[model samples]
Target: MDPKTLLQNFINGLSLGSLYALIAIGYTMVYGILRLINFAHGDIFMMAVYFALFFVTLAQLPWYLAAILAVACAALLGFTVDRIAYKPIRNAPRISALITAIGVSFFLESLAVVVFSGIPRSFRTIFPQSLNEMIIIGGEMEVKYGREVIVGGIRFPVISLITLIVAAIALVFLWWFIFKTKVGMAMRAVSLDIQTTSLMGVNVDRVIGMTFALGSALAGIGGILWAIRYPQVWPYMGFIPGMKAFVAAVFGGIGSVPGAVLGGLILGITEVMMVGIMPGAAGYRDAFAFFILIIVLSIKPSGLLGRPEIVKV
Candidate 1:
């Protein structure tokens, strides 16, 4: 492949990987604290897309405002889900909680179908149109793949740059939130030992709720960006991406934020490279995550960044 084609694919992988990373972070956070998969997370992401769709299309709000509102609503919904669905079963058996999570996931998907209908909806985003525009500068930028982008001899899409920047910013903020703030400390404490943290006067329930909210908010961000990139919305839209993000979380080391990001980028690049290198295998794109999952589990169940569990009988 030519350098321009390689660069384009590279950017595509980064963009997709960034989304996976964002969504995977949510999965890791919830599992880290509660040890629950929270299968409904993807559906929550689906809801965020609808939320943004309505905020922009029906409510006639600007895209940026819609995004903020969508994230806020997602956070609220996540908090509510934790309070109503998961909270009651907190002390129950782990299997019970897992079943509840699956049920919640189904409920969200069903609710979306009923409310939004099964048909896909399309919408526009506020992303700069100039992103797709070609600009010529010194050295006569190289363009390939018909609509390929080039600036200062570097071949990459504008959307790719935006996605990378957004991912970086989100990770940095999350790092600060997890390591610096008191709430962050409480979250870590709860994750380490909930009973002890509760005894120490930390509101365990509150911390859990905040974790759900934070994760859901990040999911919301991922959802909004996804809609902007793909410009389509449907009830089942989150299923595949959700699974991919889960794979990323596991691949990177569940419960580790940085790991989620790493896994996401790796998964994204691998998938993109696979398709780019073997276009005939594009039909198998969805299978890539499961394949990676199986390999990762077989080699290191703890994942690349995750610490192995120690059990005492």
Candidate 2:
């Protein structure tokens, strides 16, 4: 492939991977602390897009303001989900929590369909026209120049480049929060030993709730970016991406934040490359993610960065 095409493909992969990583971080965070899958995470993502769409179109709010509100609301929704769905199952068997997660996921999806209708909302109405314009080179390949960075003849979309930069910043902040801050220390303590941490004066419940909030906020940001890139939002939009993010989490290492990022980037790049190289298999793009997941699981069940579970006698 030519350098330009290859570069474009790489950028495409990076953008997709960044979104996956953002959502996957949420999965890994909650699972790390609570040992729950929180299947509704994807639905939370879906809701975020709808929330932004509503505020932007119906409320006539600026995109930046709507995005902030959407993210805040998503965080609150996540906190509530934990309290209503997962909290009650804290002492129950893990299976019960897993089942409840699935139920919650369905409830969110249904609620979205009922409220937002089944129509896919167009993002162009809200997104600035300048950002929507494309730069087509010789009618061969079309790409958005909304956010372009041309460095020594390698061009990248501003959106994809910003997505990568933003994902990296978020990851750094999350790492600092996990390792440096008081709440982060509490979170780590709880993840290591909830019972003991509670005994040590940490409010285990609060820490877990914060984990949900943080994770959901990332999902919300991811949802906004996804809507921008795809230029549409639908009730069922989160399903495939959410599943792929989960695969990324598992691929990178379920309980490790960095692992989630790594997995997402890898998954995103591979998917783009696969479709690029084999246009005939474009329909099977989603399958490639799952195939990677299966291969990763078969080769290293603990994930690329995850530590194996230790059982006590």
State the displacement of the C-alpha of residue 86, model 1, in Å, after optimal TM-score superposition.
0.6
Candidate 1 overall lDDT versus native: 0.87
Scored against the true structure, residue 101 in model 2 reaches a CA lDDT of 95
Please write out the lDDT profile of model 2 over residues 121-192, one tens digit for every residue: 787434565665554444455454454655556767768876887788888888899899999999889988
Clash totals, every prediction: 0, 1
lDDT of each: 0.87, 0.87
Candidate 2 backbone overlaps, count: 1
* lDDT (10s digit) by residue, model 1, range 1-313: 8787787788899899999999999999998888889899999999998998888778988767888999999999999999999999999998999999999999999999999999998856755445455644457445323223466566665556667888788788889999999999999998888899999999999999999999999899888888777888999999999999999999999988889999999999999999999999999989988999999989998899997861111
